[model samples]
Every structure is written in structure tokens, then in C-alpha cells.
Target chain A: MQLDWFTVAAQIGNFLLLLWLLKRFLYRPILAAMAARQQRVAAALTEAQAKAAAAEALQHDYLARQQEQTASRETWLTQAREEVVAQRQIWLAQARTEAEEARGRWRTELQREQQEYRRTLQREAGQRLLALVRRALHDLANAELEAQMASALLARLHALDGETRQTLAQAARDGCAILTAFPLPEPQRRTLTDGLQQFLSPELNLDFRSDPTASFGITLTTPSQRLAWTLDSYLDGFAAELQALIPPAGGDNASAYDQA
Target chain B: MTISPDQTILFEFGFVRINATLVFTWLTMALLVGSARWTTRKLSATGELSPWQNLLEVLVEGVQNQIRDIARQDPGPFLPFIATLFLFIAICNLLAVVPGYEPPTGSLSTTTALALCVFFAVPFYGIRRHGWRGFLHLYLEPTPLMLPLNLIGELARTVALAVRLYGNVMSGGLVAAILLLVTPLVFPALMHALELLTGLIQAYIFAVLATVFIAAAATAQEQTANLSQSRR
Candidate 1:
């Protein structure tokens, strides 16, 4: 085979030209694109990692806040419970005091009412006894009873002590009045005047009067001295004695006392 | 019948001549360049890829991997030259099965041009990587007396590279032609099929040998430098 120098030169030149064309068109652009793709993948991975870290930090912060809120809620609950218990105790104590005061007032009022009721009963009983005695003595009153009362007066005058007799005798000398429930006989009146004069003075002046209100009794009234023997006087003394015998009704012993 | 496409001169202008080999070479170059341009016109970095772009990327990445495997280094510097040599030869040989289409690799001139490129590339890469002095000193390795032998080995390997590729492609075509004259149908078709396999193998061999020569020269001093550093 004959080797051609021109052909060799031309073929080499063609090969070189083909090489430049292939490198420019095929190799460079493909390599550049591949490198760009790799860079994009790397950048995306880095950004995703950063976002994940931020999310984790936020989760931790939320957990911490939740824990703090739970602690605060627990503290508030405990304080509220304690306050409620203390308030209940205070209310219970005040209620107890009010109940005790009410009981004491009720007892005092009851005692007052009972005392008023007893007083009313005593007064009614004493008025009834006095009325009975006044009625009995009114029924029994007569001329004979008056005569006996006059005699009793004389006897009582004679039975008087020296000091009492002297007061009566001195008062009788001033002006003596003789009151009788019944009309006395002339001889009895003369007799009463002589007896009183003997006890007082021989020249004693006396006035004899008939008083219808004097029931079965005689009274000798002087300016400064009085001597009476009547059923009303005896009845007044009996009522006073009966009132002293009965005791007062109520005291503080029955006040309210609660155990619970 | 002409044995080589180079003998058929389509034009003559005084001393200069244009032959079938030259014309077919231009056609092959235009096909490769045009296809590359079309494939790379719209490339996507992250999204879906076109079937053509996938094919082109596979071809490029395959070439780079081969170079890297043989050279035991980065394939960037040697990629363009080596890829061109392999693509041109492979395309030429693969088209040989077509009726009346003569592969440019069948021409001694085209094979010589490819070998010559490898020859020049060895020294160019070596000198660039390790300086002229260090590159020249590689011939004297093991002993100074082996310099002439080393020089002859370089020339012989380059000649061998050209002759081996030319002989394989030309002989395949010659066999298919002779079988067409003799058996006329079935045997010639079989020979054409066989030629396809042989042509692909020859192209692979050419590309691999070129990569070896270049990588050996480029990394020779680097290996020596590393060895000496370790020793120190």
C-alpha cells in the first residue's frame, strides 16, 4: 500500500476537529449539569436539617411551658382547698356563737314570761282569798258580833302596855271618836265611855259614830292615835304571809347549752 | 478491484488528490459532530433525560472509565484525544458491513494518522506532566545503555499500532469481497458479520493501546517522585 502524506495530514486534522467538537458539545455541558444537580441536592438536605432542629427546639420549649403551667395549677388548687377549709371552720364557729346567744335570749324571755305568769296567778289567788274573807265576814256580821268586838276593844285597851296606854290616853284627851259597825245601846255607850275614861282620864270627852263600812268591828280614832279591830286588817296580814311563802319563778340555770 | 479506498482518487489538482477515504472520513466526522450537537443542545441537570442524551452520556462516561482504569489516574486530560480516536475508528469499522461502503480504518493513511496522534500525545502528555528533562530521562531507566533500544521500541510500537488496525480492517473487507466472488451469498454474509465483530475488537484494541502509551509516559516520573519521597 502506498501511504499518502496529504491524506494523513488531512485525517489528523479531521480527528482533532472532531475531538474539539465532541468536547465542547458533549462532555462539558453534561458534567456541569451533573455538578449543579449534586449541589442542589446538598443544599436541600442542609435546609431540611436546619428546619428539623428548629422544630425539635420548639417542642422542647412547649413541653417546658406545659410543665410550668401544671405546677402553677397544682399550687393554686392546694391554696384554694386550704382556704375553703379555713372558711368552713370560721363559719362553723360563728354559727355556734350565734346559736348560743339565741338560746340565752330565748331562755331569758322564757324566764320573764314565767315570772309574769306566776305573779298573775299569785295576785289572782290572793284577790280571791281576800274576797272570800270579805264575803264571809259580811255574812257573819251582826249586832252581837259588834258588841263582842267592843268588849274586845275594851279588853285590848286594858291589856295594852304602860307606854302604849299612855300614847292612847294622851291622844284620847285631845279628841276621841268612837266608830261602830252597829248602833250601840245607851247603856253600852255609857259603859265604853267610862272604861276609856278610866284608861285615859276621868274627864275624857268622846264622840260615838256609826260607820256602815266598818264590818263587825270598832275603831277608836284620836288626833294622833288609832286603835282598830276589823276583819280587813286580819285579811291583809294573811295575804302578805302567803306572798312571802311562794318563791320567785325563773333564773339563768335553764340557758341554752349545745354539746355539738 | 481496488484493495484500498485510498487508491480511488475522486479528484486531482496538479500534485494534490482527493480520494474515497478522505470523502468518507469527512462524512463520518460530520455525522459524529452533528449528533453530538443535537444531543447536547438541550441537556437537563436534574430532570428527565432524552434517549439520545442517555446514549451520549453512557458513551462518554464509558470512555472516561476505560481511560481511568488503564491510566490509574484522572481521565480528564486524555479524554478528548482518546475518545475521538475510539469513536472515529469504531464508527468507521461498524459501517463497513454496508454495501459499497469502505471503512476509513481500512486505509493505511488513516491508521497512520491515528497512530501518529497517539505517538505525539505520549510525548506531549509526558513533557507536560514531568518536564522535558524528566521525560527524556525515562528512556535511560534501568541502565543508560538501553537508550537506543527504548527509542526503537517507541517507533516500533507506533508502527505496530498503525499496521495492526489497518491490517484487521482491510483484511476483513478483502475477505468479504473475495467471499462474495467465490460463494456469492451465504458465506459472504457470514464474513460480513464476522467483520463486524473483528472491526469492533480492533477499534477497542486501538483505543486501549493508545491510553496505555499516554498514561505510561505521563505518570512515569510521578511514580519515581513518590517512590523517592517514601524512601527519604
Candidate 2:
């Protein structure tokens, strides 16, 4: 085999031309396309990562705001509940106070009304008793009853202690007077006068007077000392005894009265 | 018949002669350049590729990958030269099956021309990468005693690249022609099929060896530096 210098030279020239042609046509464009595609993919990945991070930040912010709002709502709810409870307590206390004041006023009014009613009842009962006594005295009073009353007076005088007797004797020296519900006969007057002379000083002088309002009783008066027994005195003593027997009304015990 | 297609002189004028090997090589170069021009006329950079563009991309990308794998370097500087070598040899050998068509690669002249291109390309890439002084210094690697041996090894490998491809392709054609005369039917067809496989493998080996030789020269300084660092 022989190497032909001319053919070798020509073939070498041809191979170099082909190399130039292929480089221009094939390698450059394909490599450029591949590089462009890789760049696009990398950029897309970076953009997606940025978007995802932003979305995560937004989610975190939303969650924090939601938690804050929830806390605020809880605070408002608790405050509202407390205010409602406080208002309820205040209203309850005010209602209780107004009710107590109303009850106290009602009790005072009731007590006043009760006292007025009791006074009215006592006045009516006293008037009725006095009327009955007056009617009995009108039917039964005579000269004999008068004379018996005179004897009762003398008995009361005789029952006095020694000091009372001295007081009456001294009062008789100051000038004595006799009062009668009715005018007496000469004999009765003289008996009264003689009874007084026996109990007092013999030199004492007395005047007799008549009082029409002193029903069924007699009274003796001196300038400094007096002694009398009258229907009015006995009726006053009877009313006082009745008042002591009945207890006083309690304050604001309307419900207690219901139990009673 | 002449043993070499280069001896088949188609024309002669004074000292200049034109032969079948030159004609066939020119025809192959025309086919390659014409097809490239046609395919690249309406290239689409960003959209769906036409079938021609797709085929071209596959070929170019495949060549780039092969070069990168062999060279262990960026395929950009070596891709076109290496790809052209493989395509020309493979196409020339593959077309041998055509009636009345002689493969230019069957000639020692074409194979030697390709090996000589690789031989020159190795020094070209080395000098470009590390300058002339650094490229000359690689022969004295490890010790200065290895200079002649390294120089012989470089020439020997280039010669081997040319002889090996020429021998395989020429023998396959010769065997097919002899088999056609002997048993014209199945044996020749079988030999032609075997030739197709062998032709492709030889083309691949040529291109890979070219890439390896060039890459070794280009990165020799770096390799030596790495070796020194590794020793340390």
C-alpha cells in the first residue's frame, strides 16, 4: 500500500471544511437552545419559591390576627358578663332598699292607723261604759244611794292614818269647802257637818257648794289641800289598767302579725 | 486491478494526478456539507424541530457526548473535528455496499490523512492550552530519560490509528469481492453485513482515539500537576 500525498492533502481539506460546516450548522444552535431552556426552568423555580414564601407569611399574619381578635372577643365577653352581674346586684340591692323603705312607711302608717283605731275603740268603750253607768245611776240613784255614798266617804275618812288625820285637821283650819253632785237635805247636811267636826277641830267652819257635772259623787276642797272621790277618777284608773294589760305594737312587723 | 484505489488515476497533468480516492472523498464531503446546509436552512431555535433538524441534533449531541466521555474535557473545541471524521469514515465505508461504489476509507491515503489530522490536532490543542514550551515539556514526564520513548509512542499511535482503520476497511471490501466471485449469494451478503458493523466500529475507534490523543495533549500539564499533588 502507498500513501498518496495529493489525495491525503485533498481529504484533509475536505474534512476541515466539513468540520467548519457542522460546527456552524449543528453544535451552536442546539447548545444555545439547551442553555435557554435550563435558564427558564431555574427562573421559574425561583419565582415559585418566592410566591410560596409570601403565601406562608400571609398565612402566619392571618393566624396571628385571628388569635388577637379571639382574645379581644373573650375580653369583651368577660367584661360584659361582669357588668351584667354587677348591674344585677345593684338593681337587686336598690329593689331591696326601696321595698324596705316602702315596708317601713307602710308599717308606720299601719301603726298610726292602729293606734288611732285603738284610741277610737277605747273612747267608744269608755263612752259606752259611762253611758251605761249614767243610765244605771239614773234608774237606781235616790236619796238612799246618796246617803250610802256619804257613809262610804265617812268610812274612807275614818280609815286614814294619823298623819292624814293631822293633815286634814290642819287643812280644815285653813278654811274648808264641801262640793256635792246634788243639793242635800238639812238633816243630811247637818250629819255631814257633825261628822267633819268630830274628825277635825271643833272651831272649823266650812262652806258647801253644788256641782251638777260631778255625777253621783262628792268632793271636799281646802285652799291648800283637797280630797275627793269621783266617777271620773275611777274611770281614768280603769282605762289605765286596760292600757297596761295590752302590750305596745312592734315596728314593721306586718308579716309577724300574719303569723300571729 | 490496483490494490489501492489511490493508484487508480482518473486524470493526470504534468505532476498533478486525480484518483478515485480523491473523487470519492470529495463526493462524501459534498454530501455532508450539502445535507448540513439543507438541514440548517430553516432551523428552529425554540419550537418543535423538523425531522431533519431532529436527526442533526441527535447526531451532533451524540458526537459531543462521545467526545466528552473519551476526552474527559469540554466537547466544544473537539466536537466538530471529531464528528466530521466519524461521519465521513462511517458514511464512506457504509456506502461501499452500493453497486460500483468504492469506499474512499478503503484507501490508506484517506485513513493516513485523518490520522495525520489528529496528529497535528493534538499538538495544536496542547500548544493552545499550555503554550509551545509546556507542550514540549510533556515528553519528559516523570523523568528526562523517557523523552525518545514518549516521542516514538506518539508517532506509533498515529501510525496505528491509520493502519488499523485502513486494514479493516480494505480487507472487508477485498473479502466481499472475493466472496462474490466464490459464492456470490449468502456469503457476500453476510460479509457485507459484517463489514457494516466493522465499518461503524472502526469509525468510532478512529474518532475516539483522536479525541483521546488531543485531550491527553491538552490536559497534560494539569494531569502532571494533579499527579504531583496526589504524590504529596
Candidate 3:
């Protein structure tokens, strides 16, 4: 039931002291620690947000670059395809041109070969006709044939005009000779000699000779004057007619033509 | 037989006297301060907490929440005073079971000291928040005729606060002593265990009552000011 004022005052002081001590030691540090932890958490959340934003931006950039690359690649592919088509067209045109040139060269060469063949054929035909005529004459030739040729010569000498006979007789006075493709018999030779002396001159010396290449006929020769009555003349006229009848090479068939 | 620890004077000088209440009060204070120091030396701002730190945080947060709930305001300014009041009384009463131990709350002088602290703290907080003139005007609320009655009521309540705590702790001690003389065995032990529970409850009541008084003084003028403005 009694009270102690000293103890009461002491308790009050002790309580205040305790209050100050507890505030200093306990509440302040605990609150500070909790606040620090909250600050660190907030900072970490902010940093994470920033990193996420950066990552999103990077992803956007990467997508844009990838899209651009894809577009460029498509462009390149399109350009390449166009180039390929153009090159193909160019190569096709070149190929066609080369083919046409080759065909033209081939045709030209063929035409040249055909013209050469035609010329060779014409030459062969002419030569064959000439050889056939020569062979027929050679096969038929003998003393009898020469006697007929001598008679033809005598007729030709008798049928000569006076002026031609005198000109021939004068040409014969210088040097007189007779040539035949075949050797004449003794009578045909004497006949040719007498026909020549009587028709041309009495004192005209006469000579007879044989020549195989004399065109299968007789020919008379003097230094500057000559007379002939030979089958070779007829053969020359026949060969000229045959040549006129044949078509000429190279004028019409010089080039070859074709359609596309 | 002494009903209060103040009668048990252990030391005396010519004019100053040291009693059992003072000694036990010091002991209780040491226990509280030492434990607080030990737990708060290394506070972990992050990561896992130690068991002692966890217990201390729970105790402090619980006190803060109580003050905030009852006062309907921020508990920051009131936390230290109220927490100390509960801890000191609770520990003092709880230690009564120890042999040769005296609880300081069982003394009228100690309870008066605590009640006086609350009595003064009410005005201290009121004046700190609203100024002396505004706080002094509170006793004249409703009319000046109620001034003397309100003053008497405040004094009576303070006396009641002290007497109520002293009567409970002193009577519990007295009853245990008498029961020890009568039975000396299981009944006294049971009463001591019961005293522990009542001691905790009384500490809670004391702390809550102190918070109510302080909050009432602190915010009463602001309410009056608002009412006057509304009337105007």
C-alpha cells in the first residue's frame, strides 16, 4: 500500500532509456534493412524491364534484316531468271544464224560441185562423140576408102573455079605436097597426082604423104597456099552443133534456194 | 508479510533507499535491453533471417500492427514507448515463478510510475501534435462546465491504471505466498503458471490502454477543429 517516489522516478527514467535504446538498436536497423531490400528488388525489376525492351528491339531488327535479305534474294533470283531467259533467247538466235550460215555454205558447196559435175559431163560427152566418130572412121578406113577420098579430091579439084585453080596452081608451083590420114594405094596415089597436075598445072610437081592424125581426110599443102578436102571439116561442124545444143552450166544453177 | 516489493529494501543510504522493486526492475530492463542488442547487432536486409531475428521481427511487427489497429493511425511514433511498456511488465510478471524473485509490477510505486508515464505521455503527444492551447482546450469540450469533471476523471483513471495493475500482481503474489503456506505444493505451482498467463494479458491491456489515451489526445483537437468548421 506504500509508494516510493524515488523508485517511481527511477522507473520512468529507466523506461525512457529503454525506449531510446530499443529505438536505436532494433526498430531503426530493421526498418532500414527492409527498406534496402525493397529498393534492391525495385532496381532489379527495372533492369529486367530494360533488358526485355532491348531484347525485343534486337528481335525486331533481326526480323527486319531477315525480311530485307529475303526480298533482296528474291530480287536477285528474279533478275537471274530474266537474264537466263534473255541469254537463252540470244543463244537460240545465234544457233539459228549459225545453222542458216552452215546450210547456205553447204548449199553453195553443193551447187559448186553440181556445176563442176555438169561441166565434166559436157566435156566427156563431147570427147566421147569425137572419139566415136574417129573410131568409126578408123574402123572403116582401107585402101578402098582412100580411093574414094581421092575421087572426092579429084571432083573437088575439077569443080574448082578458074581463078582458084590458077591461085592454087601458082601456090603449088612453089612446093607441092599431099597428106592423108591413111596410106593410099598406088592407083589412088597416081590418080590424086594426075588430077592435081591436070586441073592445076602441067609442070606442077605433086607429092603424096600419109599422116595418121590428119583428121581422117586428105590435105594439100604448099608454103603459103593450102587446099583440103577432108572429113575432119565435117566433124568440126558437127561438134559445133552439138555444143550449141547442150545447156550451159553455172548461169542458172549457180545458187541453191530454200524456205524456212 | 509485505504485499509490495518496495517494502523489501535491500540497500539504504541516508536519504536514498534501494528496494527489491528497483533491483528487479533493473534486472528486467537488462534482460530486455540485452536481448534487443543481441538480436539487432546483425540485421539481415536480404536473404534468410536467423531464428532470433525472426522472433524479434514478429514481436515488433505484432506490436506495431496492434498500435496501428487500435489507434487507427501510423504506429511509428508510439512503437517504442508502447513496446517497452508491454515487454517490461510482461517479463517482470512472468519471472515471478523464479525462486526468490520479486516482480516490480507487484509494487504500487512501480505501477504508479508506469501509469504516470502514460498520464504524461497522453498530454505530451497531444501537445506535440496540436500545441498546448489546442490540447488544453480538450478538457473544456462540450462546455466549460465539464472542465473540473474531466480533470477529475483523468486523475481517477490514472489512479485506477496504477491501482489495477498493482492489485492484480500484488494479489497474485500474495495468494501464491498464502497458498504456499497452506498447501506448499501443486496449488502454488498452478497459481504461478496462471500468473504467467494473467501477466501477459495485463501487459496487453496496459499497452492498449496507453495507446488509446495517447491517440485520443493526439487527434481529438483535429476532430473538434473540423466540427467547428462544419458548423461555421
Query: Top model by TM-score, which number?
Result: 3
lDDT of 3 by residue, B1-232 (tens): 8888899889999757899998898898888888888888888877898898888788888999999999898998898889989988999989998988999999999999999999999999888888999899999997899999989988888999999899999989999999999999899999999999999999999999999989987778888778778999
**lDDT, candidate 1, A39-102, per-residue tens:** 8788778888888888888999999999999999999999999999999999999999888978
- Model 3 iRMSD vs. native: 1.3
Q: Put down candidate 2 lDDT per residue, B5-52, tens digits, no spaces.
A: 898899998767899998887788788778877877777665577898
Candidate 2's clash total is 0
lDDT of 1 at A109: 67
Between 1 and 2, whose TM-score is larger? 1
Better model by DockQ: candidate 1 vs candidate 2: 1
Give the per-prediction TM-score of chain B.
Answer: 0.95, 0.95, 0.97
TM-score of 1: 0.67
**Leading candidate by lDDT:** 3
TM-score of chain A as modeled in candidate 1: 0.63
Q: What's model 1's lDDT at A66?
A: 94
Clashing pairs in 1: none
Q: Model 3, range A146-245, lDDT digits (tens) per residue?
A: 7788888788888889998888888888989888877888888888888888887888787778887676777889888887777777777777787666
**Against the true structure, what is model 3's DockQ?**
0.56
Error of 3 at A239 (Å): 11
